[model samples]
Target: MKNYTITVNGNVYDVTVEESTGAAAPAAVSAPSPVKKEAAPAPKKAAATGAEGSVKVTAPMPGKILGVKVSAGQAVKKGEVLVVLEAMKMENEIIAPSDGTVASIHAAVGDSVEAGATLATLN
Candidate 1:
């Protein structure tokens, strides 16, 4: 029997190896236990809702919509916050791209959105 220390992907582990002189039969390996399978989650939609010619505000990444700051028909500035998103346990503020009236809000609180998914529109 021999023991060795191995480092894999920056993780260190201790391993033991047994040497055989070809005098004994190999040990049998038991069948692996059945694994539990889980149903696939529904696909995420990147749908954007707005009137034609309206500026679309999109999410930067996949996350839950934490809050909608501006309502429909509200006037906002170019750098004003439009929505709050919760991602990776952090809160992200979605800002407006230009000064405009909020034409419509497509995302609600607690809604999950994908990257580049429009959350609102401005006109």
Candidate 2:
């Protein structure tokens, strides 16, 4: 049996290995203890009401808002890009549900959003 001390990303770990003479059996490895993490601060609420209109444009997946293409009170067409979200290393466009005026923008650039969360409201 041999023991080794390893450090990864400033985390220390202890490893043990057994020598085998004949049969090739899989060696058991124990993972390092999990590091303690601080809880994230709660997100602030948007100043304007998110539910501003009858039609809602929502995020398709969890991601960060890369850009907001439309502003409040702006007229938009169906399939027009309302917001650009970056998720899983890909950019996804959140489009208007129908031709209408943008009543409100619930997300801003660099804001993290969840799937199905409202991005904009159309009137």
Candidate 3:
């Protein structure tokens, strides 16, 4: 008998394969295979800060910066487009979290950033 372990999507399972001799019957095992429980997802990290008095806005996921709709010191309304990020082959808009002036932009067009990396700041 041969035993093997396989893991997929954080879940692990143990399997056993029995060998049969030529023209002979296979043996049966009574013990059940062991299985490891799946692990839970990790918690998300918080956003990074910018300059003083500015509310930092971070990327929700890793992506390429596609467009920047606002500039530093520009006043933006709540839910206004601040940047466009391309992730998973789709464009995602990064909107302003609240009504405030764009204090600064930490990323530019065509830049790639990691999740929770600061994208901009609103004051």
Candidate 4:
């Protein structure tokens, strides 16, 4: 038998696994107790206009919005950080794809967003 530690988000779990020599099926391991989760509210309306020629900045992964670095009408350069996201206990920065004006911000700080969710637009 061997023991291991696994972390999800910030929670750590102790797990044990046994080695088998024969072809018999291994013992079943009971899953951890399910944590009660509050239902997520419906997504708030995005305030950005989907104007022609605008580029959408999307979330790369599901995470909570940590910070918004630009506002509508704010000028941004390529490679500038546009938003900060916290996923799996790590901070990820989303940057502008090209030099342009921020058309709108669809997410606010503390909002939980999904992967591919539009965060903002640039034009």
Please provide, for model 3 over 1-123, each residue's C-alpha lDDT reduced to its tens digit, 9 standing for 90 to 100: 888777666777787878777666658775555596665676544333345435888999999999989877788999999999999999999999999988778887878899998889888
lDDT of 4 by residue, 2-108 (tens): 87666566455666777777877877786754344444455666565445337999999999999998888889999999999999999999999999998878888
Q: How accurate is candidate 2 locally (lDDT)?
A: 0.83
Candidate 1 Cα outliers beyond 4 Å, as residue runs: 1-53
Off by over 4 Å in 3: 1-53
Model 3 CA lDDT for position 18 = 82
Per-residue lDDT of 14 in model 1: 60
Clashes of each: 0, 0, 0, 0
Write the residue-wise lDDT of candidate 1 on 25-99 in tens digits.
Answer: 874434333334433455675444445326988999999998989888789999999999999999999999999
Ranking by TM-score: 2, 4, 1, 3
Q: Compare candidates 1 and 4 on TM-score and give the better one.
A: 4
TM-score of 3: 0.58
Tens-digit lDDT string for candidate 2 (6-74): 666555566677777767787666665644443345668666543498898889899999999988989
Estimate every model's Cα lDDT from 0 to 1.
Answer: 0.80, 0.83, 0.82, 0.83
lDDT: worst 10-residue window of model 3: 44-53
Please give the range of 10 consecutive residues that has the lowest summed lDDT in model 4.
Answer: 32-41
Count of clashing pairs, candidate 3: 0
* lDDT of residue 68 for candidate 2: 92
Alpha-carbon TM-score of each model against the true structure: 0.59, 0.64, 0.58, 0.61
